[model samples]
Target: MTYSQERNKKMHSLLYKQRVLLEHTGKSSVFISNDSHKYYTNLLEYIEGDLERNIYTIPVLRKAIKTDSYEHLLKVVQFFSSNTSCLFDVKYCYELENMEYEDIQADEYTNYILYGTEPVTANGSEIEDFNPKYLSFYCIINMD
Candidate 1:
């Protein structure tokens, strides 16, 4: 299949998966919440950009991980680490597993990379730091 066809297929499959998740929540199928709709819309946009611009996006990375597309996944990781103001946390078990499965060296993965200069805060004065780089990663993994 051509690249465009592959991207369309991926988007359709993701939409179908989201529909199934919505069904499981016992919500009306027609009433997709604004947040969910926005998420899907952003996801489609990212996928299209990845295909057309030859750039890797977060959804692409997540799909690569899911399909065991290790090389592409690594490329995404590297791209986020170097090119974007994104930070990645390597704490999740699944992420660890992906790293191991792909035989990615620990050093190669940017360590404690912070995505933004401004500190992330919660509960006024309690500061939390998060890597913004993996925003795309989170979006893809959390896609219902």
Candidate 2:
């Protein structure tokens, strides 16, 4: 198949998997699995010199949070699909049954949290200390 055709097929599969995950979990948002850490690390290493970035650094994160977490995942997939030869996959996307917030944050896949908070406008008012809950996203990026 052509590159575009293959990308489209992968995108379709991603959407289907996300839909199934939403239905099974009864949650409006879905995140990539934590098991995909190495892939993300590899992606960061390819994009930057080190794994110093996280999902929040993505330019689309702010916009994605305004909608739903799943939207962020879609945008991320679309970005890699259109811009690079990397194959992004969420085959390991699954809920962490007993993981703690601290544990999740410390995970190599999500260790990219900024130490400071930025003022965020909420309900038409600017909240100085708005700490919004973030959904973790992890996916495999097979650089071809």
Candidate 3:
């Protein structure tokens, strides 16, 4: 089978598994099994390194994320997808700071304490904080 075909097959399998898990748990989102998460994390790390070097594209990256076999796959995919150019740029490592943790408490009595505030925007307004320098690099390669 071709590379594209293999990727498609993997994506399909992942989606199927996610659907089954959701149905069984009655949850709308995907939830990876503990063992699956550990297994997939190692796989994802390798794939992500390749992606950073521009050895992969959006579709291939999407397949990798879809086939993650872990709950963290969605977040990993989003992070890489959002910064495709960063793969080639070694100077800028993608970072997400101050992410709000998802609520897991089963009790209904506790009020949800919103931990993080959403960024707001005003018409024709700009906000800039330049403490952390951000840079990305890319290179042209000829495959012959």
Q: Once superposed on the true structure, which residue ranges of model 3 sit more than 4 Å away at CA?
A: 27-144
Q: Report the lDDT tens digits of candidate 1 across residue range 1-144.
A: 987787667656754554455345324423234433433334344544454333444455455344354444544344333322122233211122244212222322233233333322222231233333332233222222
Residue range 1-144, candidate 3, lDDT tens digits? 987666555545543443443345433223335444543344344453343233443335345545533335534433322332122211112122473212122121111123322221222122234122221111221111
For model 2, residues 1-144, the per-residue Cα lDDT tens digits are: 987666556555644453454344333223334443323333333433222222333334333233344544455454444333234433211123374222222232222344343322222233333333433445453433
Q: RMSD in angstroms, candidate 3?
A: 15.6
Estimated TM-score for each candidate: 0.25, 0.30, 0.25
Badly placed stretches (over 4 Å) of model 2 are 27-56, 67-144
Whole-model Cα lDDT per candidate?
0.37, 0.37, 0.33
Q: Sort by TM-score, best first: what order?
A: 2, 1, 3
- Model 1, global lDDT: 0.37
